[model samples]
Target: MRSLEVCKCSKTQAWYLFLVLVVITTLSFTGRVVYLSLGEGYGISLDPSCKPRRHVVFLKTHKTASSTILNILYRYGEARNLTFALPFFDHLGYPQLFKARYVKDFERNPSKEYNIICNHMRFNLPEVRKVMPNQSVYFTILRNPDQVAESSFSYYHDVTPAFREAKSLDRFASRPSTYYSPSAADNHYARNLMWFDLGGDHNAQGDPSYVNSTLQALERAFDLVLLAEYFDESLVLLREALCWPIEDMAYFRLNARLRLSVAPLAPAASSKLRQWNSLDWSLYSRFNRSFWERVARYGAVRMERDVSQLREIRRRLGATCLRGDAPAGAAETVPAEIRPPSFGTAKILGYVLRQDLTGPTRELCTRMVLPESRYLSLLQRKQALIKLPHNMENRL
Candidate 1:
């Protein structure tokens, strides 16, 4: 009886292994390369013919998980030694419309092509085309208007005149027109900020004809518009579109506010926020549907699997690179140099890497968590050095 049981188990194991091989062969024939780890049950399906895209233009919108996306871009470009269309300072001439000349040294090399342009800028397609290559893939991110308004009110409370005068988000929401003025300095932050960032007039009324035309224009301009609400799923589609390895999309959330600092919007205030930022509301509502449609086309099951894989990749890297819980040790854990600067009442937090890391591993881990300002400075220096020959490199 024991011998009979052992024989049955052996046959079942052999049949399972044979079925696995058959499935893999079928998938391979269908243009997917499946990599399987024996005994681990881990596998990845990738399109072998897809070449990694290099030229990309990420319109870095404010307070919509754009900081995290920028960090990913910074890492990818730096690792590959690609040229960036950097601004003279931290960002391209923002608050003012983006112009080709706004890029540092763009005048000296009018025809120089940059591989990536992921910075805070007022979107201008023609001006952007002047800086990037002809085949660049353009994309941007969006967030729900209510959350954006809440975050903006907190972060720009003191910076924008309207928010400063209103004193609180609730006060501002209750009677927005009373405090908000289109002509006032930094008033853009107080309403329809996302629309303004996208180079649309923040003060535009919610005219159906005008809004529809503007939305259609944006659709024509951007290849993909990601939703911040479905960030992981968005990255899945992004990876497929860019043909990048899932690992390349690994990111740690940066410039996140502490929960205590985040103001709670009452139900009434939340409704008012949507009404006040109606244009931004329409923009978000439109792209949100498109974003899901993209996921459906990408294959819901495939997307779920890829997102799971991405999360695993991020988890492993986070374990290896980051120290403590995220938004960890605001003062003691991270070096003072890499700590993010405070914005209004928003207490932006950063990461701390394990002390034992050294050499290239340490460098990679450090860049993954470096604050935007510090990373920008580092890239500026590196690019500057690259531009100069070895003989004249020291002159700077």
Candidate 2:
């Protein structure tokens, strides 16, 4: 009787443990199902006609309003209940590879498969193909090299450690071999311009031929080409190609910088700039002319119509309203005391930062120390003015 009682107790304990495990597994499965359902339903509306398209890649470039374009693409994916192979970081680096197991994940559960990917990635056709094997569309943008270089110089000067201690554009330009060479630092503009102009490969010795090869490769791979100078038209072409709804093609706003009035370039300065970026300028001018020629062959009127339609769409989408205009009132005017020094260290820094620096010393201030005191006073005065009530009319 004692043996039988012991056996019965052991059987009961085994059954209890099995029941608990079964319940836990059921709960886990239920949670996963709920999560997937929510994710699929996110940003989706009642559009049965909208189907998830697969295998699209966007190669985003710098200073080209790529961020705004990416946002539009992201929204479109969300609305159509599609997934995207988004970048791990806001910008990518190195071997320019995507490690995300997008295909495996899709195969496992088979929820709406991601069809779009927009990231600041290096051009790697092989890596991209690994993720998207089916019929895929690839595209990227190009900007005028001179403008791109100028914008890049300003951007690095303001933001980076390399340019912080340096005092002039001349010094920066002299060291182009440092940043532009194969082993140089990874900067956006230089790297992108080089890759887009030359083929995406980086040989030990920097070669312009690589750029031409890369362009040829891209021409073979991509179905369409977009120019940064004509972004709105490009967007329209993209929308038509994808057959996306008008609402889906609406632009997104991002990364706006204050527009400064550009000074007229001196003849000598212009010549120097041309010399500094000769390879880039040559590549840009050639490609730019070719792009336009291709468009002309397609019909200029159709392009104009597309641009007009995009502008109207932009207005309707409330994108234009986000742009900043010149500040209102006399307060916008610069006070004489706070005006920039006629010659100072900042001027020297600006001069040195230029692509060419062989001009007379008279053009640049010799001062080494920053003009911080004037800048501080200006900041304080601006803060005080801001705090003053709008109704307090002519108190100053």
lDDT of each: 0.81, 0.47
TM-score of 2: 0.57
Candidate 2 per-residue lDDT, tens place, 297-329, comes to 656887776566555544432322222222212
Give TM per candidate.
0.87, 0.57
Off by over 4 Å in 1: 1-44, 389-396
RMSD of 2: 19.2
Model 1 pairs whose backbones collide: none
Candidate 2 residues lying further than 4 Å off, grouped into runs, are 1-54, 94-113, 158-162, 165-171, 174-184, 187-209, 261-283, 319-396
Q: Return the TM-score for candidate 1, rounded to 2 decimals.
A: 0.87
